[model samples]
Target chain A: MNAPPMLEARGITRLLGEPPVQVQALKGVTLSLQPGELTLLMGPSGSGKTTLLSIFGCILAPTEGELKIAGKSTKGMTAEQLAELRRSSIGFIFQAYNLFPTLTAEENVMLALDVRRKAVTNPRQTAREALINVGLGHRLKSYPSKLSGGERQRVSIARSLIGDPSIILADEPTAALDGVNGKAVMELLSKISLDTSRSVFVVTHDSRILPFADRIVRIEDGNIVSDVRQKRA
Target chain B: MVYTLALRNFIHDRISLIVTLVGIVFSVVLMAIQIGLYYGSQQVITGMIDHSNAQLWITPIGAQSFDDSAFLKGGEKYAALSRPGVASATDVAVNIMAWKRADGGQQAVVLVGTDSDDKSLMAWNLIEGSVADMYKPNAVIADKAYLADLQVKGVGESGEVNGRKAVIVAITDHIRSFTTLPYLFTTLSRAREFMQLGPNQSGFVIVRVKPDASVAAVRADLQKNLRDVDVLTNEEFRDRSVHHWLFATGAGAALIAGAVLGLIVGVVVVAQTLYASTKDHLNEFATLRALGASAGYIHRVILVQAVLSAIIGYLIGMAEAFAVNWATRDTQLVMLITPGLALALFLITLTMCIFSAIAAIVKVTRIDPAMVFSR
Candidate 1:
C-alpha cells in the first residue's frame, strides 16, 4: 500500500495557437504512474511526448485538463504552489544536461538542495555522496566542460535525485549519449526507481529505453496511441 | 542562493562584464574627479573668506566685478566705523599685479593688504614669518604654492613687486583667485605703494559687528550711508564670486556639461552591453524558468547580475581616477575625488544598472517555458 500510484494526468488537452490556425500539442493524455514504476514515453518526432512531459513536471500549464500529483488536484494551483510541488515532488533531467556551467559537479547537486531551501548542514559531504551514487565521486571538483557526455548526464541525474523528489521526469535523458553510456544511464534510472520507490518517467524516441521501463506509453500526433505494461523480472 | 547563481553567471560573461565595467569605471572616475575639482574650487574661493571670520564685508554694488581692482577710500572706513552695529572697520586694498624677478621673468600675484593689529578680520593664517611684520616696509606674505613659481625657495627670499623691493616674510597654504595668481599679503600702505594708488585708496572695507548688533540693520545703514555701494555678508560675497566665475562666459558650465554628456555615454555603453549579454543567454534563462525558478527569481537574478557588474565597474573607475589624481597632483589640472562624489557615482551607476536590468527582466519574464521544450 505504501507503493501506491503517485502521479496521474487525466484527459489533458493542450492547444498551441489561437482558434483558426490552432495546433494541438497534446490531444488527450491519461496515465497512472505508480511508485517504483519506470515509464518510457516512446513516440516519433512531433508526437507531443515532450509537451506531455513538461505538463507532468508541472512546468507547462495545460490548456485544458486535470493533473494530480500525490493525489492532490493540480487545478487552481498558483505558481508558487506549482514551484513547491516541482521542488518537493518532481525532479527534472533535461536532454541538454542543463547544469549550471559555473558550478562543479558537487555544487551542481547542491544547487538542488539550495533551490529547495533545504538547510545544507554539510553541503560538501552531501554533494560528495550524491556524486558517489552516480559513480562521479572522483569528479567532484570537475566542471561541466571537463566532463564527458555520460558523466554530464550522470551529474544531471544526481542533481534530480538530490532533492529526493517523489517523481523523476527525464526528457530524452539518454538521447545525447552513445549506446554504452545510454544503456548505463537507463539502468541507473531503473535501479534508482526500484530502490527508492520513486516513479521515473522518460520521454524519448530511442526504443532502446523500452526494455528498461516497467511500462511503455506510445504516442502519435499528440495522442497516446497505446500503453503497454511489461512485468518486471 | 539566487544571488550566488546570478553572480556566477555575471562572472561567466567575461567580455560583456569587462565592457560594462569599463563604462562604469570611466563614469565613476570622471564624476568623482570633476566634481571633486568643483568642490576644491569652491573651497579655494571661500577658504580665506571663511577663515577671515568677519561679520560683514561692505563694498560698492557689483564690487566683486572689480574684485581684481577692489579699493575703498580710506575715508570710507571712518564713516563705516561710525555705524551703530559696527564695532570696528578697516580699509583693505586688492590689486592684481606681476612681481618682476631678477631673472628677467614675472610672477602673477594678487596683493591683499590688511592691518597687522586686526580686531576685525584674520584673512590668511601665517604659516611662516611673523604676522606683526606684515606692516613693515617691503615685507609681504606669499602663498606657499607660489614659492616655486617665485623661484624664491624659502621664506626671507627678497623679491620686487611692481619694481619695488619686497621680502617674502610668510608663506601660506594654496590660496589663489580663479585666475591662479599667487596671493601676496602686505600692509595697506605697501599694497597702495605697489598698485600706484594714493594712501587714501583702498579696495575693500572690512567691518566687525558688535555682539548685540544686527547684521541686516547694519547692512541697511551702510547702504543708505554710502552711495553706489553694496554691503554683503562674507558668505554672500563668496557665493557671488562663485556665480560670477561659473556663469560669466558659461565656460565652466560648458565643461561640466561635457562631463555630464560623458556620463550619459557611459550609461548608454553599459546599457547596450547588458542588453546584448542578456540576449546571448536568452535560452539559458528560459531553461532556468522551465526548471521551476519563479519569474521573480529570474528577474532578481538579472538585476543582481547587472548591479554586480556595475559595482565592479565603479570600483575600477574609482581606482583609475585615483591614479589620474596622483599623476596630476602637482599640475594645475586639479583632478580631485571625494567620498560624496564617489557616493553620487555609485548611485548613478546603480541607476544605470537598474535600467539595464529592466530590459533583461522583461525579456526573461516574457519567455514561456514551452520555448525550452522546443528543440
Candidate 2:
C-alpha cells in the first residue's frame, strides 16, 4: 500500500483583514505534499503563496476546509494545540534566517526542543548533532551576527531539523543568497529530502532553485495554475 | 538556555542597555529619595515622642503636636502619680526659645528640658561630652549640625537662650526636630528658670507605668484623673505628633504630595524604559513564534527578561540610594530607607516590569508569523 502524504491541504480558504476590507487570500486550494519529495509553491506577490504556506505550517488557520498532517485532521484545534502539532509534526524556515542574534547557533537550534514543553534528554547534544548534520559543527558557538548570510541560513535549517518533524515548510529559503550559496542550499535540501523520506515544501519565487525541486506548483490570484513533476539536476 | 537568551538580550548592546539601566536606576533612586525624605521628616517631627521611654504622656488639652501645645495645668505630675497604674511621673518642659548668636544674629531654638537623671528624654549622639556633663552649671547640649546657626565653632562655646546665660557643655549630631530649629538640652528646673515660669509649672508630664500595669489601663486612669490634661500612651502621642506635622500643616502636605508625585513619575519612567526595551526585540519575538514556540514559552522569555532587568535595576538603584543616604547623614536632608521600604520598592519594581511586558506580549501574540516570509 502507498503511504499517506506527509502534509495535505483540502479546499483551504482564508480571509485576510476586517469586514468591508477583507481579502480572500486563498480560495479552494488543494495540495498534497508527499514524503521524500521537495515541492515548490511558486507565485507572484499577492498570489496567496505565503498564506497557503502559513496555513500548511499551522501558523494560521484556514477560514474553511481542513489541513491534515500525517493523516490526522487539524479541525477545531485551539491555537496552542496547533502550536503543539506544529512543533511535533512540522518544521519552519524563514527567508530572513530568523535565528536569534543573542543566541549562539547551537542554542538557536535547541530552541526547537524548548518549545516542545517536554523534558528533552541532552538537548545540547541533539542540537550539536543537528548542526553537524548541516555542516555547521565548527560554528556551534557563533551568533547570528557573527555568521555570514549562508551560515545563518544553514543554522536556521539546522534549527528546523532539530525535532526531525515529518514535514518541513520553507519560505524563500534561498531568496537572500547569491547563486553559488543558493545552489548549495537547494542541493542540501534536495539531499535531505531524498535521504530522509521527509516532505519538504518550499514557497519561493526564485526560479533558479527550480532544478532541485521534485515537483513545481504555480499559483495566481489565489488559485493553482499549474503543477508538474520534474527530474532533479 | 531561556534565561541565557534573556540575559544575553539584556546585556547585548552596551550603550542602549546602559541607557536603559541608567533610566531604571534614576527612577528607583528618585522614588527612594522622595519616600526617604518623607519618612525622615515624619521621624524628625516626632523625634522627642519616639525617643522617650515614657509609657504615657500628659499634654495640655487640645495639644496638636509636641511642638504645638499649650502649657499643662499645674499639678499635672501629681495628678498623674496619683493614678492607680502610675509607677512614676516627672514634669517636662518644651518651648521654642530665642538664641543670641555669637554673630550678633538671632536664631529661634526649641529647648527640650527634662530631669538630668531622666532617661526618657535626653540628648543622644553626643560627640564631644558625656550626658553627665549636662549636670554642670549653666550647661546645655547643642547639635553640631546647627553649630553655625548657633554661632558657635564647637563644644564649650557659650550661647544665650531667651536672654538667659547658658553654655554649651556637650556637642551632638543629627538631633534636629520638625521645626527646623535648634534644640538645646538642659535640666527641667534650669529651663523653667530660663523661661521664668512658676516653680511648679511644667509644659507636660512624662509618666511611666508600673511593670505589672497595662499601658492602656494606665493611660485610661491618667486621662480620667488628670481632668485638665490629655493623657496618651507614648505610641499614641508619637502618632499624634507625626500626624500633626506630617499631614496637617501646609509644609507637611506639600512634602507628602511631592513624594507621591515623584513615585508616579518614577513608575512612568521605569515602565516606559522597560516597555521600550521589550519592544526593541519584537523581531526576535516574531521569529520565535514563527519557529513554533508556544505562547507560554514566549511569555516566559519576555517575563524572564523583565525580571532580570528589575532585579539588576533594583540592586544598583538601592545601592545608589544608600550612598546618597550616607552622604546626607550629617546634613538636614536625611534619607531613611528601612528594610520594609526596600522590600516594597523591590516588589513594586518587579511588578511594574512584569506588567510592562504585557504590552510586548499582546503585540507578539498578534504578530503574523508569515511576515517572516515577506521581504
- TM-score for chain A in each prediction: 0.95, 0.96
Q: Clashing pairs in model 2?
A: none
Report the lDDT tens digits of candidate 2 across residue range A192-214.
88845599999998999999998
Candidates' interface RMSDs, in order?
1.9, 1.4
The TM-scores of all predictions, comma-separated, are: 0.91, 0.94
lDDT of 1 by residue, B30-86 (tens): 776767667666666665566666767777567753244755555677888877889
lDDT of 2 by residue, B41-112 (tens): 878877877777788888988787777636775788877777787888888888878899887778998887
- Cα miss at A226, model 1 (Å)? 0.5
Classify candidate 2 by CAPRI docking class: medium
- Global fold similarity of model 1 (TM-score): 0.91
Per-candidate DockQ versus the true complex? 0.42, 0.70
